[model samples]
Target: MKHIAKVVELVESKKDDYIALANDIWSLAEMRYAEFESAERHASAIEAAGFTVTRGVAGMPTAFMAQAGRGGPVIGFLGEYDALAGLNQESGATACRPAADAANGNGHGCGHHLLGTASHLAAVVARDYFAAHGIEATVRFYGCPAEEAAAGKTFMARAGLFDDLDVALCWHPSVANSVFMNATLANVQAYFRFHGKASHAALAPHLGRSALDAAELMNIGVNYLREHMPDQARVHFAYINSGGISTNVVPAHAETLYTIRARTSPEAIDLFERVKQIAEGAALMTGTRVEMVFDKACSNVLHNDTLDAVLDRNMHAIGGMNVTANEVAFATEIQKTINPDDLANASRHFAAALRDPRPIIPEILPYRPDVERPVTGSTDVGDVSWAAPTTQCLTACYAWGTGFHSWQMVSQGKLSLAHKGMLLAAKTLAATGIDLVGQPATLRAAREELHRKRGLKPYQCPIPGDVTPPPARAAGTPAARASQDVIA
Candidate 1:
């Protein structure tokens, strides 16, 4: 409470610069694990603010950590800046207008540009508040990368980066503002490669063993298995290699990426095993060799009721965002581009929480800790939740009903509405951080809640010990060319 006013005032004073930083990241549109410039911008700002910066943490070149203040309860703020590929839309446009100047055809479709800057801004404000008040506490900003497809935080957790954190705070850009209470699905991602002998299709048809056939059979098997899988469980696949374009020859090599999801880590891993067995069956039937390469895995979110309550209080205290008439009109136009089904889904989901039917959801949604909403989506934040007493909030940044990873969300990435939401999130986060610092009991309660939920067992990382993060590739290289063909 002592520095809450200062935190809000500080965020407001530097709002324009923060917005510019977010927009710069949006323009860079760097993909997962390739956000060098974006990370540098954040690190530079942190350094300028008198924080010690640690670049390339957890063996990721794009990942970094920044800290300020002396020894005390460490409050970690998570930030992400990776963009999605092929989502390059021009900012402030209502319709789908891809930016022609985009070199990699990527965009901040998920609003990580705003997510990163807001969290970073919160960290800075909190650091300043503690220093001015002579409070003994540490504030940290973690520049997490590759959260879009790769589980960057999962690797960091495995590397014990979050182990020392007393409590971690994170936020996402969304159409509604609320503390995240729903538990997301845990998931495992792996690539299945099938290798077989090659032969001319027109001549030596009997002698050839087609790997493409094996891959197709594996997909078919998985589809059939889906019927018997749990209702909330999901299995998705994409072709990474279809052997070759020539149909006249039997394709000798084929690969497919599979993402298996379930309510928990054990369930997801179990489903992954079943899928692997199906791959083996396909390989055996087609006389091909199958190799499974584990890509990444993330655990289901662990709820910390203590932290959740604090975040909810902070959000309500911060109140709702104010949208101007022109901003509302622009949001309405953006909503028009969204699918009717998505709009309907959003309406149903927020029917009880929302106060008005405006294009922008300005009001903070009521926190519902009693309700257990099933989230089919996955986030690397899930892994962080397991490592520490982590809590996340979502602020209204995009237009209501605007789907993530879509061009519509990218169109509003640099808009005033987004900037307002970003600042709101920053203030909320800063207030919450101040509370954690001033009230030691709250941090203890949060940590105890995490321990009680976790029992005596330690946090087990979902990623395998042998697996390492994929190295960043240069543009126009063979690996980059190959990556362009594959869907993550």
Candidate 2:
């Protein structure tokens, strides 16, 4: 607790700089592996803070690692800078509207702008505190990218980036302030492409084996396979190509993207194999060749009760955000834009943690490490958890009913409420990092917990070794500029 106060003070003294960094990332709105400017900005900030920064790590141009301190336990801070596509909304606006100069047709709907900045700030403050107090701990910031639709951290973990970490701390922008104790689904995503010979429909209908038909059959088969799968398992797909626009010509090729999820990586991988079998059956039925191209995958979170308690202590010590009347009013307006069903859905998630239905949740929720919420979503952070003893907290950065990846969330990305939440998370992480450095026994306990939870099973990268990450797109491309008019 010696450096906790000093670290909090350091974070407060540099609040303006952190806020500016978050805002700049918000404006840039870079997507996935192409976060060139956003990654550059973070590298520059940490480099200027006297940390040695490594650019373009883990086969990702946008991914980097920054380190400070000389010895002692190694503490890692996980950060993400990827923005969602098709969410080009103006910040601080109550109503849904695109920004005047929405570049690249992307927005930080998930609040990763705040996520990366706060983690960076916490690392900077914790590093400074360790150096000043002679605590002898190494602090690192992992600038992970493509967390939105791609699992960038999964690849980073595969490359032995987190092998030396004693413990890892991360935080997310959420609707409530609490420890993210529940387990998330482990998921695998891939593209199934079918190929067939093309022929004129009018002249030789029997000669052509339509790839589109095969793709449709594959989807139907998977839908039926869902019933036999475990109740918790899920399969979702979308057609990337319907072969052709013209009905007069027989389609020669078609592509579909599928995402398979389960409670664990082994389960998800087994389910993925089953789905591949369905694709092969469809190909046989239609006399078409099918190719399964692996996209990406992330493991389920290895929840650590020991580290969660440390984070909870820090969160309670830091307290909650102090919302002004005007901020509450803005949050209320944002809530009005949310659908009733979405509001009810959010309430169910918060039922255990929150009793008051305030538009802005300004209180820290009780820690519930044993509660197992149904696995519905996934994050690249899960891979980091498996790599080391990792734990993350959630801070309120939006209205109670503001669902992620929506215009409502994007509208409040740069507001004062969001900034308050970001800074509070920074303090909590900084305090937690300091605690891990000063207390070796506590850190050891956390590591032991991780080992017990994992048992004898070793960590395996879901992505195949032969596969590499997709290349970053050029700045001026049509796909980069295409926009989706998602109003809600």
**TM-scores for all predictions:** 0.96, 0.96
lDDT of 2: 0.87
Worst 10 residues of 2 by lDDT: 479-488
lDDT of 1 by residue, 147-172 (tens): 98788899999999999898899999
Give the range of the ten consecutive residues with the poorest summed lDDT in model 1.
479-488
What is the TM-score (0 to 1) of candidate 1?
Answer: 0.96
1-33, model 2: which lDDT tens digit per residue? 556678778999999999999999999999888
| lDDT of all predictions | 0.87, 0.87
Cα-based lDDT at residue 470, candidate 2: 76
Per-model C-alpha RMSD: 3.0, 4.4
TM-score result, candidate 2: 0.96
lDDT of 1 at 428: 90
